[model samples]
Target chain A: MIRKALIPVFMLMVTFPIALLLLLSFGKSWVYPNIFPDQFTLQHWNDIYQINSELLMVTLKSIGISLGVSSVVTLLSFFSSKHISYSVYKSRWLFLAYIPYVFSPVILAATLQFYFTFVDVSGTFFGVILAQLFITYPFGVLIFSNFWNPRIKAIAELSNTLGGNSWITFYKVVLPLSKGVLLLCFFQVFLISWFEYGLTALIGVGKIKTLTLSVFQYIQEANIFLAALASCLLIIPPMILLYLNKRFIFTNQQTI
Target chain B: MTNQLLDIQNLSKAFEDEHILTQTSFFLQESKTLSILGKSGSGKTTLLKIIAGLEKQDNGTILLENNDITTLSAHKRNIVYLYQDALLFPHLNVFENIAFGLKLRKINAQEVKNRVTKMLYDLELQKHIHKMPTQLSGGQRQRVSFGRALIIQPKILLLDEPFGALDVDTRKQMQRLCKETLKQYKITTLFVTHDLKEALIMGDQIGKMQSGVLKTFKNKEEFLNDPSTGIKEEIEFWKNIHANEE
Candidate 1:
């Protein structure tokens, strides 16, 4: 049947780019009219192990920034979204959360550039993390806004009246109930921080060299091998996160 | 005054310019249930929330056991409030849901297990102990919610139309179970509902709320005799139906 025949085609289409990237990361070089590289080598992989490697440090820096941004944004957004959801002026607050998204990340970064430069956090490692939050935090708030409904509010109230302190009520009831949304929000925002380029470039002032910027720089310099390597490195964390999300959060009728 | 387990004096609440509850006051004796019957927008739920410390009153004094708990936080109030929806923790199984309050108090794990098991048996949910809340029926979920609240041995229990969403048969069954359990546990409860029969059946004392003002009756006879309670119209309607059948 057409459906059955199309399955492998669809799968190959989905996987071909990643497979090509992995293969190209080990290739020596590509020449004109060659579908594949002239030779394969692990020199680029070996380069990653060299002492004081920029690639290695940049990769770690990207992971650290994404992790930091995702965690703080997710936690802050979860609580802030709950407060906003319960507030009488809910729509007004939600409109404020939407302000950052009204512009492209680059333009938002440009507007915030003055504040960052004035505070002297621009071009610093912490600066990029803070800049990423400007985009991710509001997104996290928007994602979790739908999670806190009247029923959830009632449940929290019930927990309080059942003799649970605020901390107990959150970890015992709210966190457990919000696990799926939390994970989904964390993953999405992690990706946002991970693949972010324009905002990072503008705010980081090119001093904070993230893995995503390295990929863009390599591609611009026509360094196909290193570009593929950077792409492979970039895909690893999000793929693992996606696998974990599927295995745990979505397995047993859980929904965000 | 000493026998009065819970007392509210001059309670009032408002949202923006509209007053939801104004100058409402009542008292509940120890080990007795007070049923407040009111229609929607009658401020019955606001009164219950204020008593449970979930909402702060604009003006009031709430005395529990002659102790002024006016500004006490909700968790410290030792008051358990049940919502119309069961609102069970969906991630937890029936046993875990019942054990939630005990765990929150840092009780020993084995004792928590035993107490929750006993509560589950009492609620006739022993077979569904391992099932998640979403796997249970509405009546079963409500029973679990009750167990969760009652296992903590709260000082006062507030029910906000707890069985309002159940079917007629399930509602009757839940009412009977609730009455028996509250009696056995000697729980002083403030039960609010809109149903006339349910209000009369569930309470040792009866009150009617209208337009933010609550009037508590001394006895069933007084409540029935009062023309404002609509008891007379209810009785006449039933009597006329019976006569037509004859």
Candidate 2:
């Protein structure tokens, strides 16, 4: 019972820093000697808007890239999972498909950097999206495959007997049944894409900028206020998306 | 016969070195039901799977209305197999699960709605149409499974112990419901069960299988009364098992 009570306390502890960052973004700065800032102002927030449009463009670009990566990863995972689940070589190929995810991100990125340079697609959005998709695709496949394999053949048979062709069975019967898993996959890929830094920085070079990049830049410049403000801004959109996702998706269903 | 919906000839199947079925043959006229009875490893489920095209037979031919479907892929055979556990898609509600086949066929919204609504009413699942599979009672989920399979109007329905997961009373109720629904639809069915009583109640003809060969009889009376067969021993085995359980 005490353990249960401590959980909420722990959660509050974890969230305190984020809350403090939000507070700091509203023009409040806390010095080490004092318990609280002497004055609270919105100067940092205003400074962000006034100083540069790069942040705004970067935010929008991050959203687009994340969405693009999520969609592509979802599609690739969906088909590959379907194939793996139904194929005769499921056990063998499934193990092979997981190799990319099991490898360290830095190693994978370094390997891809060599490959991307060779292919002449280095430092492009496409290159970053592709790299990220590879990282996220296995997770998608693993999630969907866990649900699809044992159930797909049975459901497909049921659909076919009911006058449904293969495509119809997939779209109507299989897809609807897999809605929960797909939503989960989408969110997972989105999160991975949004906060991903190592692969993006390595592959995207200096041309592409994301919110994570902006946060890193401000922190490097020793502007703790700006960095905290940027981190707060970076965190808001994903939190809102996650909130909406939890509210609307799954709808009381426990996804496998 | 012209009306014989399914005919199996010298069907045999092996998994690795273990023989599941050997030289098994059967015939089912349209709208008739057959039950396969056996012990746990007696290959009753394997037989059903082979007929449903989910499992391959090593050396036999399966004819669906005189059309060879022995080599047909499961998706092309249109033989619906219900699992012991109702494998209703967890993400879809009862109505949507039942409507899955129609939607797959690209049936328009109105027709799909009309058919699914009637099926829900027919199965007495109207109130639970919006409920997820997990929220349903075992009997309710089996009924949804039944409706999901029936809505597709398959060439033949293969039941792999559909009510096996329910409690005894609920199992009895589901069995009765299944019998009534099959009669109403006049759909050909092959039900596999280890329960002799269930087979007697649901099967138009009962085929007792031992090892891999099937010994078929026309009805319950012959199945129980045939002196040359091992029906008595099978019944005694079940009786002792149940008695021990009690």
lDDT of 2 by residue, B104-141 (tens): 66789999999899888888999998898888998999
- What CA RMSD would you report for each candidate? 2.0, 4.5
TM-score of each model, in listed order: 0.95, 0.81
**Candidates, DockQ:** 0.70, 0.41
Candidate number of the best DockQ: 1
Clashing pairs in 1: none
Q: Write one digit per residue (lDDT tens) for candidate 2, span A1-256.
A: 9999999999999899899887766656567797556678877676657647677778878998999988888878888788787778887878876898788776799989999999987888888888887788887887777876665777666655555677777786677766777777888889889999988998988788888988998889976777787898888878987886787574635442
Which segments of candidate 1 are over 4 A away from where they belong?
A: A252-256, B244-246
DockQ of 2: 0.41
TM-score of the second chain in candidate 2: 0.91
